[model samples]
Target: MSEPPPEPTSIGTWAKRYYYANRAAVEAVLRPHGLGSTQWAVLYELTTSGPTSQRDLGRVLHIERASLSGVVATLVRKGLVEQTPSETDQRQRLVMLTDAGRSVWKKLPDPFAEVRTVALEGVDAGEVATAIRVLERATAQVERHSFG
Candidate 1:
């Protein structure tokens, strides 16, 4: 008989589980406002970062070009985002939130706080800090080697 496969590592399994769980919660919160997690992320970035180049946004968000294009198109159609040719580079597009977008962003409930509270219910502050540090290092390492 074939040998059984090795057990999955806790870190990878938990990371993926956490992502899906968090995504579901975020989706539930955003759906009523006609937004998906990806779309909300784009809007949130524009809100905090001011006008940003489309290429840069994709890079920062780790979004594929095709997916980003579709999301931007949908946001544009909804009148929540405006895209203009970059002043410095005509080939590049700059994306920013419209007044409507800002209004919606203002009205949307803070999604992360509730999720964080629930997820960290019994977790201590030091544990949280350690988790954050580990995740940050992992993120930096991933970014360093990432092609997208």
Candidate 2:
């Protein structure tokens, strides 16, 4: 009889697994704060970068166009974000973190640090650095592949 297909264990598979698992962990901790992972991700991006176009934010957050509306709506309900018309394009909107959003983000650093510390407790900093490098290269590859 032909052997069954070998189980997959490529870098991409492992990376995606880690991505989902990591987000699950974040969601578990963040949900109590009235935020989901995607919402936090949106806030994080806006906090790190400045106010940006909804399309650009969606692209960076990996949120599909159809779903981003709901995400923004939730944050708006929470009074954590604001959407204003883009200066250049009336058709486009820019999303900015409100004072409330910044407040939540500021508070998040401590819990997030604790989570990181727990998750990486056994892994050395060197390993973390290497893993980051690997992930960055993988991200660049994916971005190039997608855009090209």
Candidate 3:
């Protein structure tokens, strides 16, 4: 008999798998509002962070500039976002959610809550807290090393 295939090594791989799985469920919830995960993320960032430079928004979302440009364009066309040239730096664009976008955001159901509840169905609260702490620490370490 052939030997069993080796297991995947990186934690990042599992994290990505989890993200995609949860994203699919979230996408289903967002569909009625005519939004995808990327679009929703952009809107969420704008709502939470207030008006921000496009470059800064991309950095916050960990999205590539090119990909974010396309998403921003789509949101602009849909009347969900408005992009204006920055007063301080005319070359930079500041993106903000329109009133309609805010209204839609308010009306939409929480996309992650139900999926997260299902994911944590049997997990203990303490264990979840520990996992979150560990992940946050790891993310901070990565960012520190990455920038330095």
Candidate 4:
């Protein structure tokens, strides 16, 4: 008789488990600051890159413009970021971190760093790099299949 399916050890299963676990870890760290992971990413980008156009920020963050607009609006309401018309391109809005944002950035813990440190405690750098490449390839394949 034909054998049944193997145990659930697929890459997708592992990737999803890790995704949820990592997200949970991140949320736990940022919950006290009232920031979601996407918000944290936007703040981090502004802090490191200075003011950036909304279009450019969306591209850099790999987020949709509509989604980024909501995130930026939320930050503006929180007084964490400011949106100003670009001098060279009045049609474009540039997003920059406010003084409060800098303060919060300084105070916030690095969630990714914390999770990575603990998760890779026993794993070697080469293994980590290989895994990253594999995931990247898989992601690209999925993206191409869906959009291409």
Best by lDDT: 4
Per-residue lDDT tens digits for candidate 4, residues 1-148, read 9987655898987898899999999888889989999999999899889999999999999999899999999999999999999999999999999999899899999889998798889899999999999999999999889564
TM-score for candidate 4, please give it.
Answer: 0.86
Show the lowest summed lDDT stretch of 10 residues, model 2: 109-118
Please tell me which predicted candidate would have the highest TM-score against the true structure.
4
Least accurate 10 contiguous residues by lDDT in model 3:
5-14
- Pairs that clash in candidate 2: none
Q: Give the Cα RMSD of candidate 2.
A: 3.9
- Per-residue lDDT of model 3, residues 1-98, tens digit only: 99865457666666677889999999998899898888989998999999999999999999999999999999999999999999999999999999
Candidate 2 runs further than 4 Å off? 1-13, 110-113, 132-148
Q: Which of 2 and 4 is ahead in lDDT?
A: 4
* CA error at residue 70 for candidate 2, angstroms: 1.4
Please give the CA lDDT of all the candidate structures. 0.90, 0.85, 0.90, 0.93
RMSD of 1: 3.5
Q: Over the stretch 1-148, how does candidate 1's per-residue lDDT look in tens digits?
A: 9986545766656788898998899888888989888898899899999999999999999999999999999999999999999999999999999999999899886666767788899999999999889988987898899585
What is the TM-score of candidate 1?
Answer: 0.84
| Poorly placed runs, candidate 3 (over 4 Å) | 1-14, 134-148
* C-alpha lDDT (0 to 100) for residue 78 of candidate 1: 94
TM-score pick, better of 2 and 4: 4
